[model samples]
Target: MVKLATVPVSQVAGIGAQKVKELESFGIRSVLDLLEYFPFRYEDYRLRELSEVKDGEKVTVAGTIYSEAVYQRYGKKSRTSCRVMIDSTLVTAVWFNRPYLKDKLTPGIEIQLTGKWDMKRLQVTVSESEFPGNGGPAQSGTVQPVYSVGGTLTQKWMRKSITQALKQFGEIIEEVIPEFIMKSNHFMPRKEAIRIIHTPADTAEGKQARRRLVYEELFLFQLKLQAFRTLNRSRADGLVHGYDNEELRAFIQSLPFELTEAQKKVIAEIIRDLRQPYCMNRLLQGDVGAGKTIVAAVALFAAVKSGYQGALMVPTEILAEQHSRSLQKLFEPFGVQVGLLTGSVTAARRRDTLASLQMGLIDIIIGTHALIQEDVYYRNLGLVVTDEQHRFGVNQRSILRRKGMNPDVLTMTATPIPRTLAISAFGDMDVSTIRELPKGRKPIETYWVKHDKLERVLTFIRKEVSQGRQAYVICPLIEESDKLEYQNTLDVHAQMQHAFPDLKVGLLHGRMPSGEKDETMRLFSTGETHLLVSTTVIEVGVDVPNATLMVIYDAERFGLSQLHQLRGRVGRGAHQSYCILMADPKSEVGKERMKVMTETNDGFEIARRDLELRGPGDFFGTKQSGIPDFRLADLSVDFEVLEQARDDTAELVAQEDFWTAAPYVALRHYLQREQIFQGELMD
Candidate 1:
């Protein structure tokens, strides 16, 4: 017999050609897909008699229709009212906007209504009459599962499809979980769990079933990562860029500023990793303005001085240009050759740059996504660095990694990830964090001011402008929207113009043309613009040391991480800086978030709070990256389970050679099913 997972949904009882589109819309093409579409919520159908029900209580009532329902008209409003008898008690059932129920509510008809119960005047009233035989048996009052349905698909249809998939093919529903794990975890068998998951007798059964599935998903995910890590480490050797401590010391001494202990520690870690023959997959994390770029430049310089090439891939054109200029200034003084190549560069210049890179004439090259082009070859590329690592997916990073014979990979992110999430998401990579800011970078004074104090903030900003300093005003929205009540960039821009008419004001948002945004950013980077009104586009790359004031309107509309990033724009120079959070938040959550920003400027602390507030999904952000997606597990709420799975999987990996192990063959097959055994990701 064909297994349930192998059966197609189209071959199911009621899923015809027309209904196939809706099922496919829900990402269900096979019977296994339909079975895996777990209910988001469940409905309890415990019976309650009419006399036993209390006022303002929701319940399921069983009764027989004693009188026919009528669509009685009252002024401009209409309704259907019917008298029902329940076990010697009389009650009324009312439905609003559903007058057609009159035809269905014939006399002597038995109905089970599940809805809100209220005492209207003198009689017990229940609205939202659910017809009998819709899903579960009403007399027995069994608990019901509510599946998510979209478009023309109904919940009844989904339940029916799942029923058909399970009943006819129940014998083919084989158990994939190893028996040892199932017994040790006190989990129900797979077949029993599936049955209860779809139609549980009560909430306890459903909870147990859901727990087993969630654990299965998380354990498989951890196992896959462990297998990939073991396989990935066994690849061919990488270029060992021997470190020169004296050259590094000279470079650091020549800099105008001194490196912090945090920077020195992380840099030393990188140097140690580069000396190893195996490929290095390390993630460098830090707060904004932690001097990550300079550390990277030094690492690349080490690779270059060892007679090898280096490539740094950033996320934007302007950032690439910024890095190119900074690198040229730093490396040229020591006779090191640096080159730039981007999509917008002239053809002649790009050809010359590519030729130099291939010929090893250029020591280090920096560019955007264009650095990984099909024709862009590297000569002895020893180190690969990706800035803003979250912006690149695993495949893009892999393609860049393949430019050389497994060159050491160093990915850098300014976004601070909470420790729990860092373990769950990036456990495969070695991590180094720059936890302290460089010396002499003054802390920006942060304040949370209500909307009524706007005038005082404007006055302060004007005073700062008069002192020959620039300011950045950040808004949550680019334009007005009926749905969102946050401040708009255009409205804030207009208000700034009205307040500081003599000052050069600029407007910037993501909706504007790229050239226009670049021009506006350039104007703000220099002293040409005194007050730049913008959105979060200036969150990551804008490096203006002269900008000493950052005023964020509707500050509660953004996350703490984002507010921190916006605050980092200022306090870059010696002048005292201020970050005024102007917000009139209504919810306690919003108010608390604003308080966190004002209480501390430490990003890692704020990130921990953010993880507590938003969970793991929003912690690393929605940006596509190498982090594996979890189908049923959340790292924030399920940290205990994640840790357990990590330890258990490590034990399994240590005990067996995955390919030939008999007891764990099912797990090995599952890994292959998920394509985790494929070596493309490893090599």
Candidate 2:
């Protein structure tokens, strides 16, 4: 039998070349793809008797035309209305801009109308029309699947083509899940589930079919993730670092601030990973300003104390330099050397840093993408730490790890990930989270204000600046855009300078050169520039202690996570910082975002709300964030199913014969064919 996935849609009985072109636009290419193209929603076209029909119900009613159609033309549009007799009662049927309905609804003609019945008007606003004997679903018990399509493909044609495809290839649709698991879950057979999903007898059956498919998607994803984890753990060449060094203990004791309980717990997890025989593939995540850097510092110290080099890679040069300075300060007393490598570093300095790194003189090296260059070599790279892990791609991380022999990897991020997304996106790695901020930290007071209050906000900023403090003014765009009505950074910079002529104002955006951005940030950090106006470029690890105010213009345009991150920029210092959200949002979602921001400073709670409002795709840019775009599975609502799938797959993969078992042969073959399994497991 020909495989459904191998057969092109063009080979289907009725889909011609033109139809194939149209289907390709919807991302449907193969017979399997055509069969799996599920509907976004369904319509109940089930025929109802006149006595059973209720007012305000979207239903289908068939009747015979009792009167001549009345047509009225208003400007470029026309209206057609007629009376139809259902049993003994008469009901009015109406259509807009449909002059052809007048001739179609002649006297004594039987017609079917599917639309809403208005109670007060005693009329059926017809959206679709059909004749009794035209072989349409005019009798009763008909459900229509509403697909997302366009460009020469009508719903009727799409339904017909899918029906034809199923008739030809439904039996050959192989079941990938094992039969024992199917019996345990009482799942519908794969073939029958596909059939019922497209043309179910009722809503209940459609729901059952959907549950089965959703479970399959999440289970397969979890299985692949577990397989990757198992493969990584099989290697025994990982370095086992020592964490009980006297200098490390002394350094921890000498810190100015105490570690939060959450930070201590996460540091313990990382220390445990470092002592294992296998490489550590761990993700350390926390809310912004949750003391993740201190925990990371401990882990890096352990690696260095074990007589091995450590590499810390970040997204931007500013963050790298910041980490370099702080770590140097923390480790200088302990005689641990720290090196900085960035794009803007002079060639001579970079050469010297590279030589020091190669000769093991640098105990810890911090850099941006420049760290991964060809010339940079490590003597004994034991632990690899990448901050803002989402900023770097999987290949870039793999390359950095490959610089040493099976070194342990630790990736850190300040963005709080919702529990469901963490499971689906980072399921292959061990996760450690820090949720509490250090003591003496003040919560940023947030307020949502209208645009008309801009002058008052400026006055507030002026007062704060006059008190010898600094402020940050953020905008959504870099320059003026006719397309988007957002306040731009350049314009905001000029306005701030004019608003407070005595205060030095600086401008920064992504479009600026690296050196200029660094300079602007330096001036702000040193209190030379009292007001720094910029875009979301300062959203991440740019920390200034004296900055006490963050004013966001057009705050409604940003997502909850982004708004939270921007707000986190301030409140890092001991001052009572304030985040003033300045915009009047028009949409309900925009208003809800502002409300959520003002209600809580907890990043995890905000993340949950963000996931609910924007979904997983837009939460972190699904394509770039390594989140799987499952067709039927929604991370927000299907988290329970996702948990079940993760557990089941993890248990199954732990079995000794999981890969070679007879019942899993088809699954193994599919995984291998999809490249979900590595070369060692290809047998």
TM-score of each: 0.84, 0.93
Cα RMSD, model 2:
2.8
Q: Please state the error at residue 386 of candidate 2 in Å.
A: 1.3
Residue range 457-543, candidate 1, lDDT tens digits: 999999999999999999999999999988899999999999988999999987887667778878888799999999888887568
**Model 1 lDDT, residue 671, Cα:** 83
Model 2 steric clash pairs: none
TM-score of 2: 0.93
Please identify model 2 stretches exceeding 4 Å from their true place: 8-11, 17-29, 48-58, 74-77, 85-91, 117-120, 134-140, 676-683
Model 1's lDDT to the true fold?
A: 0.82
